[model samples]
Target: MEQNNMQDLLKRYLEGNCTPEERAQVELWYELLDSKKAAANEAELEEDLAEVRTRLAMPFRKKGKLFRYPAVAAAAAVLLIISIGSYFYFNNKPSGVPQKANKLLATDIAPGRNIAILQLGDGTEIALDDQSNGAIAKSGSNTIYKNAKGQLTYVATESKEDETDNPVSNSLRTPRGGQFQLTLPDGSQVWLNAASQLTYKISKTSRERLVELKGEAYFEVAKDANRPFKVLSKGQVVEVLGTHFNVSSYDDDPSVKTTLAEGAVRIVETGGHRNVVLEPGQQATLDSSNRLSVAQVDVSDAIAWKNGKLNFNQSDIYAVARQLSRWYNVDVVFKGRAANVRLSGEVYRNTNASKVLEILAFYNLNCKIETNNGVKRIVIE
Candidate 1:
């Protein structure tokens, strides 16, 4: 069909005046365009669409008036009509309605949210999400507050000698489908990922500011020339005067990855008897064999979760499943050859599980959610 004829057909289809065959053809064109948009990067995709719009505006240019249709509607019609040829040429197999791919799931799972628990030194657990913005607790000279934005902060007050004598530790932990940020007494900031924990002590007299981490967290250390900051995770200790970095030491993950965003850090692996210094934009990975390696990487991708986005760049199916499991609080079971497939893209963390699975299906990977006894499981094939 000519461009002009195809555009007319699409306009009729959009207006619900097309025959069944014409509607199917338009819908198939849209499906192909959506698949291409999903695979293209944001900037490149926008450029390509702009060219399409120019070509689509030619017919209207022949007339003295502008296109009567809205810009969005016009763009959609153009995309549908342009893909008509490719849709028929490449897809010769019997084409039925795409089977609402993600609907096979028994239940839809939601994404992670800002939620965490704070465990005080005295064995008290405070649900940070339940508490309002105010002073929640007091630990010796340190006052703990949950701010309006759901962040936990620690402020120190002058105390008597007796109260200052004993140093108390506090831990901020995020359950599955939850994440939280914290401001330490010394002014350092920490963003904890889902299913992660960070423990630190508040003592003005302490020479060093140290914290232990499990799973993943991004840290922005406060500069203290006299006191170095240290993070302990999976038998590895990262020491710095002041720096921004991310650490991932989840038990299920095979390696401990530390990516430096700014400044410098010295990573020491106690078990491996190895030490390495990482500069800005460098990542150090300590594998199961206790070997440490360094390489340059995109720092934003490493900290995307803390920024409320999921960046999967050449990530294997198992890695993608692990992230989904953490953010959705669901168990994942892989059958067949699901673990070997790799994917790359960025999506909002707040998107629902069904939409996420649907995006995965566009990459030719099969995934479904199953619920049994109130527990949801994602099976990838």
Candidate 2:
């Protein structure tokens, strides 16, 4: 395919307008590019990589895909075939690296996996990480099951006459370095991020489906006009009949961001009685003073974590540190000018802390891993 044609297809794919065949063709081209790069010599590899970076630096409009960097989109261009493997290979190498002094401290601090704790209404806690797949517990008219993929699902059965009036509430929590997904009694699905909690009541009597959340979560609400789905996070409440959206309300973060992927939502700030409505691809931010602001955004970037990727678009070092702290369950200490550094890229969530820090080093941000009484700390200078 020609360069312009390939770029057009990629734009269409990012905009969710590509047909199945076109999507497959682009994917196959990407695979071939990676394979070819793997077999290329160092000189040829570097040249192709430079072209990839140049293509990535091309500016795109807001209405198109929100790429953290042009290099991300450039990788899909058939005119310039570059392997992404070179980046990983170069960034992961530790030979003659200055940060090698603290290499030993980087051990054991790995990426997070599927893990959570399920608390029944009776105050009984089940360690979801240790539990095997299958039915785990029963809450009133709901049957809680853990699937082979570690997702917790709720199946509603015929409600007993005695349980109709009494609704039992259950809570699911993901500690630092953990994450989990669950299907609510009403069929609404939610993916909870690290150090987050979600509480919802399961009953057939209630006309509204409501959930309380802390930290961050991506919701795919089931449509039921009669019973509106509502989410309460921090001091804000988001009400929607049925839609796909994400909410970020981490206590340590200064702002709460609600991004909608499809349909519509109404955000109500309980602290100030303020409300705002959001459309698809729009984000509403609530600051400390309960002030609300809305802006156009790339919904895919907002839900990147749920898709197993960390995306940074002109984000500062502190923002990157926050993500690392949650995923690796480690503390980040900025010693010098590290916090001012800005980064833009996409990385798999499963990448090790050391590898990620190494990539930061490429951008002139020095980092080292330190251990104090067995607790790992990432110190940037």
Candidate 3:
């Protein structure tokens, strides 16, 4: 590789585009410099690392904060990260860092922000992040707005004519590392979590206000005695008149969880006769094997994501890894025998990936950050 292209190579390595040999060369280069006090240009290496971090938009490690971990997998007492001066190396490079760590090496994934996509009734898509705080579209008798608080709201206006029959639908979708809030035509409020979608009927002629949920969402439904609000998720229909609840039915999850916070809700099986009526502080779970069960639970843990926190209360490492993966938009891979670990902690959703990994390290699990084609992955050993 040309001397000048080292920057390019580093970027390729960070972006997961580098070949195996190229990656090894980069790590070998790190090994050569970790302790080598060769009188070469120290300024050049510093500039290269800084430029790579900037190009990849990685968060810089704090200058003096030390990452402490106990003996973990025979690697306990390993100091994972030192102040922003530790050298970056490849897999299984070493057990410890040198005297001074390198400044700004590329590898932290940022947390998700307020982001979502809105599909208009006619099929026009609007990226919520790109639009300003104003009316974004008109749906029948309602005007949609990206409000000042960044919520997609449907405000009812005087109707000139009817736009109904099959229910004119508008949808909101949040990609990985994204979330959004919106109000429906029926005055219901919804908080769409990361990698989730909510499609609500905008037409007022329907006798029942209906919406389809794919991933997960928190609903604060508006009470309408005449029109019962129904959410059609995978295998179940959550019917509510006026209540607050959460439904998690992601494809990756092993079950569909419907947690009720306030009021009451009835969970009806899509094609079966199984049903359960839930009261406050109750949870109804529909498992993969088509089993329906209800239990008393703490509802806060269910809506923690909506309130800007990662609550891993009574969660195993795999569950924690999945939450981290969705929030940080990273894939998680276990390299060796996976740890039999369950954890309980609350971390704000606004922090970067390193902060959460540091929490994992505290529990003695080895976590590493890797990248491929602009996506970050959390690798555990």
Best by TM-score: 2
CA shift of 175, model 1, Å: 0.7
What's the best-to-worst order under lDDT?
2, 1, 3
User: In model 1, which residue pairs have backbone atoms overlapping below 3 Å?
Assistant: none
Please give the TM-score that candidate 1 achieves against the real structure: 0.75
Show pairs that collide, candidate 2.
56-70, 56-71
lDDT of 3 by residue, 300-336 (tens): 7899898887876557888888888788887889998
In order of appearance, the predictions have TM-scores of 0.75, 0.78, 0.72
Q: Which ten residues in a row have the lowest lDDT in candidate 3?
A: 69-78
Error in Å for residue 105 of model 3: 8.6
Candidates 2 and 3 compared by lDDT, better number? 2
Backbone clashes, each candidate = 0, 2, 6
lDDT of each: 0.75, 0.75, 0.71
